[model samples]
Target chain A: MMTLELYNYWVVIFLMMAGFYMLIASNHLIRKIIGLNIFQTSVFMLYISLGKVAGGTAPIAAEGIDTYSNPLPHVLILTAIVVGISTTSLALALVIRIKESYDTVNEDEILEIDRIADEEGSSA
Target chain B: MINEHLPALQVVVPLLAAPICFMIFNNRLSWLFATLVSWLSFAMAILLVMEVRDGTVLHYEFGGWAPPWGIEYKVDILNSYVLLIVTAIAAAVFPYSWKSIQKEIPKSHHRIYLTAMLLCLAGLLGMTITGDAFNLFVLLEISSLSSYTLISLGRDRRALTASFQYLIMGTIGATFILIGIGLLYALTGTLNMADLASRIPALEGSRTLQAAFAFLILGFGLKLAMFPLHLWLPNAYAYAPSAVSAFIGATATKVAIYALLRFLYTIFGSSFSFDYMQVQWLLMPLAIASILFASMVAIFQDGIKRLLAYSSVAQIGYILLGISLVNVTGLTASLLHMFNHALMKGGLFLALGAIAYRVGSTQVKSIAGIGQAMPYTMAAFVVGALSLIGVPLTVGFISKWYLILATLEKGYWPLTVLIIISSLMAVVYTWRIIETAYFQERPAGAAPVTEAPMSLLIPTWIVIFANLYFGINSSLSTDLASRAAIILSGGSLL
Candidate 1:
């Protein structure tokens, strides 16, 4: 069995790859948003994971307790998660609007329309 | 209380102004309030820069908790320079937005537009002032998200698509940055920039640290629109509302560059970034390539706004080239270019907003013969163009002068010649617009073009005059940029 320390770093890497995969490869607009969510969540996990230490308790004041996980990273990750949620909501809103205007959520179809618009303009 | 509280107030004032903008609900009142707040914040940034100019880093701890444990706002020479640039642009842009927003955005969404602008301002300022790496990511998202909203609000239906594309790319960039920050935290166990600088040397040789550095540079590089990762910038700048384009083009990516600069030298140390990692090897080539690529692409675009958008990418290349030199002169050149480019581009976009307001189109053919009608606006555009082309006695010339000297200092003379040649390319693209505006005669039976309203022209020329003023007497900007460069390269001024 791997030590807890080893597990923490490995888990962070796994989550990172998952997010990158969604961001780079996904086609559906909503799917890409989900990928971004997963990607950001993985960062949260990495930060939280690093804060954990062997034999450390929660970073709260307690009787007869000394060692605790670093609270700073945890605090930072909390703010980051909130920011992630806001960006996700905004992304979803933009997608809804894109769907309404373009009538298709695919990147390539949108590019085709834009290209056609450019061609028509140049021809004019 | 307010003396030490100035840094937080610089951001919090704008943050609070946004919600209040919504509560007022009248578009005109909201615009008035936004302009006032932007000007006030500009004043505060000036005062804060003066306060910190004595080489004292103003460290403000939130809730009375010290740094390395609690989040802190670290105000130093570099951030103050960025603060001045962002707020100065906001102040200059807000007055222009009064009429421009009415013409481009729906009247019903004016409050929304004002709110987004304020939030974007706050986010840019927060990114500049925050002393923590993770905090930098949070502020980066704050600005990026608001910016997406601002861009999508463009009158064009395709604006939504452009904003979505930007959202996708911006999110990926932020994620890469977060991963980089996470890796650093894992190795150093500290998120504060100063603390990380002190602690990272112990983990210098570790693979985790190296990987973290790589991720961080790549991530921030995307945000700053470093050549290959710059896909989001041009389209977003092209499609966004005029006011949005002017502000973000001037400040957003520059703030990201500041974040990159902070991370590279302040947190990771120059020895690690420049020597051990040799980041310049990659950055220098990409920077030179982007200058050529983006400028060439810009020259070919038919849409005037799209042309300026591509030009912004090329300007970013110049800033990066300065940073890639990894020396005092190079850093100073980068920092000064940050201010000068903002003034020039902001002026150009604001002028376009005026033209777009009067003529009702931003296409090159649409604006043909506008120069005879709106000579003042086009003249301002010419001044801005001259700066972009690095003409003598302009801000761009000062920046390029320092950069060429820096390159020659390192015996990279070929790059210096390339710099001059690329600048000639700038003349070509800028002349494209000038020729379209003046030399081309008006088509018969077309609608008569009139000058833009005083509101827009006043702000546009303010930025225009700023270009000339700083170009002539660059002692202030140059001094601050030099101090910032020293602080950055010295590794630990705290």
Candidate 2:
């Protein structure tokens, strides 16, 4: 049942977990963005792998290609990649602003700053 | 000619208008243009609703490509109603936003704010109308990204952190939805919702389908701010500009509920989702917890917006509770509440925005006795608060009444009691506002405040009147909700 042929999926699982762990475990905002990118990449890989067919050529109208890999997932993944890029850029821009405002990007430190502000605002 | 393309025009009008607002580069002009476009969208939505009133479905193909091959725009009783909710809320928010944003946002960022607002409106509308899974994912991102920009535009530096937190959470949620759509596509090789629905019955026992269902529910639950996953909503609403809190607070999560309904009833069918999967068992406890826990938490929040945000989480629980009932009355209650809550919360936020304009903050204590200073706005807020608490003759009572009936129909006395308890909690939180604003006197020597501008007051009252109007009539919304719920729970609309 442990098929070595599904190694691509195994790789996807590994990368998805690694990146997701980084997203949750990391303190630095920039590192969290990187982790998000990695997590997105795993999904991209998942879609790409789902399109493969044994002995299939590229989805092009060539001379003799009876079997061709599915191209729809690739097209969908392209859109996903664009969305992923926008998210990363927006996230990075927010982090830069956050850094300038709080002067730190560490999650705990930022929370501490906000918490102190909250305490003072309430007490005032 | 236009009527033939109502579904297409419904989304395209606002989608194209976003960039035009950006091009205008003048806040006043852009605001005028965006408001007009939102009205146009709302008009089209009303027309679409009329056409679909007799239980007919309207389909528009993208670039002439038929469904199961290309993206499609589909309209029916359910989505047309949802389209009205989003577009109508936008229509109300846009004019109110013109004045509110002037005070809450910087002059230079005004055009950018207008652009983001239009884009977010378009995105929400598009998400409501699209029948393709991938297209919905794309539109969801479009809305999420614009909302992040909108949230970030607030004057407070904390807006940056709030928007960032929401970005992280929203992105994760969208990705989870994408993963779900990918799995569905892998299983069925079709992105069209109707085609997938027709194909799904044969694949009910597949693990991939189950995983897709789980991912979709989890993803949507996060987006809709269902209880424990709602950590991102409070600060995001609290720190965002007043207009943004009003606009997004009204429309965003409601659209998420529409999406979840589509997946549950239309695509997967209720029997598979409820009977086989038993989603009710998992959903019930969480919904109950949200109703009890979020309401309890709302009683303690200092910021009025934050408190309302928590109440939103609990209101969402009520919606989920209705869905979990899997009965027509239950779903009717859910849909009715979605529309009613939009009016109540949207009006409350706009009134809060007016207060913020006059007083500079929305904290409960900061509003002390200013009720006399801003009688009109405070009155509107009081009506909205009453609606939020389900007082009779307001829209809140209409939906909550149906919810109680739904539970009673199911013979679930405990749930009925729980809902009543939560409504009482709503009274507690809202009473604090009433007492503080009406009973306590404004601190001596505070700047003498005037009423909100006519521009702001008109829209707030417009929404507040709708609450009373809809609550009193109840026929239009109740009729539509009953039919839509029947369609969903029946899984027979297609």
Candidate 3:
């Protein structure tokens, strides 16, 4: 019988795998980006869950708190959240440019166009 | 003040200079500022190497909080060597950019170009120096994001597409790395590499630890462009701006390789990573495949840039082969090849940049007879090509010799033979370029060829000269690489 924490971790792992699978399987680049977000958010939840203490309060040094959640994981997750945002923004920007150039967001179509371009380039 | 702050200043000075370069707002001023910033970083790297040569490690605590509290900038023979390679390539490329960028990039975009170049330098340097795992990922993003911008800024429409592809792949790589770090932190309750190293041993047999290792290797494998996972690389290199190609071809993947080493040896114990888990079993076959497959691909590339791009994949194979051997000598070979690959690949890309500057295209057909007119540039290419083929008296040869010796030491005889055959494949691809450049007749009505400007030629020669110099007198590189290798093999040695 796994503990609650172990169950949380397993759920997170499942979510991560589902996200990765969607990233690989999706034709739409935006959907791929969405998958990446899901993947990252699951990891974020894992981190936050690990930081919880049995009788802990919020990790702020306010009036008369005897116990608190480990502040380190919270602080680390803040940085992770910032990184995730940057990645999402960058992926969005790439998708926009990709759509402009290929007039499509589908991976198979873009790859086909690129392949045709290469063939035309060599034969010419 | 800056003298004592070599470790941080190596990254900071360039990072701050990028915005200042933009603020200058004039093309000439921007170019000058960018060049000065690159030289400043190079000088700082040299000083860091001098300070650490005595084997004393410098650990700079950020905000005066020591390890396990605040971030740290750590430097030893390993990262100092990488710092030198990154900055040295930047130093060489900055001057070359003046002539090359004028031809390839729009005059209006000069400020952005200079700013992006400086940012890329800062990111690579920061990634090399940081001792914290999360800090490493942040710097990795900084460099990876800036590099995508630099690549897309190229004139070709496909440049935009190439940059997009790289962004997708690079994002995946970065996310994987972050997940791995997150897992390690969750398991060990810390993000510092040194602290994690101490904590990891007690949990060696844990499934979480094993998963963390798996994620780290896979994530970094994408970043390093390890053999089967290298699909994103050749096109990215082939389509990026020439100067961008040269700088990244030299530095980006090498920094990833360094990060892999930091995690594998420093954070994860060598006994667990190499011996117990046997990562070599996976690394060995993949490295061999990359060498043969990428080289075979290179032999058929019509464009010089794409040829070198495939060749970069092959070169990465040699580095991994060195690493997979899992001994001090093998590690030395890996480290030495990191430097050696940077010089030769940088030189090759710069040579192609010069031709691209002159002929307006990198298609080999365009440059057939131009070699006669651009003799100095072609000569540099020949020297670079010789280095790439690993001929004696070239830096590439020295690294390959060490790699072969390392394999033999491990009693991998078939592997030794494979290494030799790959070098022969290298010979074929290099000879193809040399034959096309010098022997074949120029296509009719080709433009009257003039040599690449002295600015580009001088910097390209700096690497070419280093290649031969290191090839003959390899003691400096060998000493540092071997020492770093020993440190990586186990903390027990120290």
- lDDT (tens digit, per residue) of candidate 3 on B395-446: 9999999999999999999988988898898888888778888899887766
Instruction: Let me know the DockQ for model 1.
Output: 0.73
Answer with 1 or 2, whichever has the higher DockQ.
2
Model 3 spans > 4 angstroms off: A1-7, B491-494
lDDT head-to-head 1 vs 2, winner: 2
Clashing pairs in 3: none
lDDT of 1 at B234: 78
Q: Which stretches in model 2 have alpha-carbon errors above 4 Å?
A: B491-494
TM-score of each: 0.96, 0.99, 0.96
TM-score, candidate number 1: 0.96
Candidate 3 residue B430 Cα shift, in angstroms, is 1.5
Expressed between 0 and 1, the share of native interface contacts present in candidate 3 is 0.48
* Chain B alone vs. reference chain B, TM-score for every model: 0.98, 0.99, 0.98
Chain B TM-score of predicted candidate 2 relative to the true chain B? 0.99
Tell me the lDDT of model 3 at B99.
90
lDDT of 3 by residue, A23-74 (tens): 8889888998888888888888887877889899997788888898887877
Steric clash pairs (candidate 2): none
